[model samples]
Target: METDRKYLFTTRIPVRWGDMDFYGHVNNTVYFRFFEQARVEWIEGEGFRVGPDVPTGAVIINADCTFLLPVNYPATVLVKMYAGQPGRSSVMTWYELYVEGDERLYATGSSKVVWMDTRTGKSVPLPDTLRARFD
Candidate 1:
């Protein structure tokens, strides 16, 4: 059993020169991508893997975000990820973004991903190994 009551995953992503829009600060779209990297790495860190080999692969069915602060170039922001809920074949990941050296959260959001059979392209049950990691 993955007894990690609070699974915290963090990554320091260097704000790319191109990530900023004309208005400056990392574009709103980039934050979602940052959140995705955190979530994917979180799952990959576990022994469980996500790929075409699995009968079911995950797909983001829903996503939402709130920008509390602006992130600019030459900065490394921390993206935090954690499992929100795990059901039969779906899992929701909660995330928070914090600028380095700051204790305040810059953004918070959650995404719902559902497992689907790659071959059949239909929703399926969550693999036991992956499900076990959830609280």
Candidate 2:
């Protein structure tokens, strides 16, 4: 479903031959990887580091994907990210994937990310600076 989620960012990733499985198309599991790459790029683009280095970080609580079409190798995938309204400590993110140069949607997905204190592992209010990015 192409929901009207607010667009936030877009990135392009070239499909590798290794992404394909025995069925001769991209494996089902790799779609999450594609969604992840886009999410990471968007996070870093906003000038935040993901791993243990940060005092607070984002953790995805859940993720889901609906595959609509198969993607083959030798293509560059365009992953578009959108955001739902930001909450006190969490937000929902959506993704749309398509082969670059083509408008046809191949997959769509979403994940809920919670901002938490890295050390304590408890949810914390989102940073004001980062919160504006969602607007």
Deviation in Å, model 2, residue 120 alpha carbon? 1.4
For model 2 the TM-score comes to 0.94
lDDT of 1 by residue, 1-135 (tens): 123325558888878999999987899999999998887777677655677787657788999999888888878889988775578888777788998888988898878878788899888987787787674
Q: What is the C-alpha lDDT of each candidate?
A: 0.80, 0.91
Residue ranges of candidate 2 with Cα displaced over 4 Å = 1-4
lDDT of 2 by residue, 1-135 (tens): 335568989999999999999999999899999999999898888888988889998899999999999999989999999998899999899999999988999999999989999999999998888899877
Q: Give the 10-residue window scoring lowest on summed lDDT in candidate 2.
A: 1-10
TM-score of every model?
0.86, 0.94
Highest TM-score among the candidates is held by which one? 2
- Shift of residue 52 alpha carbon in model 1, Å: 5.1
Q: In model 2, what is the error at residue 96, expressed in angstroms?
A: 0.3
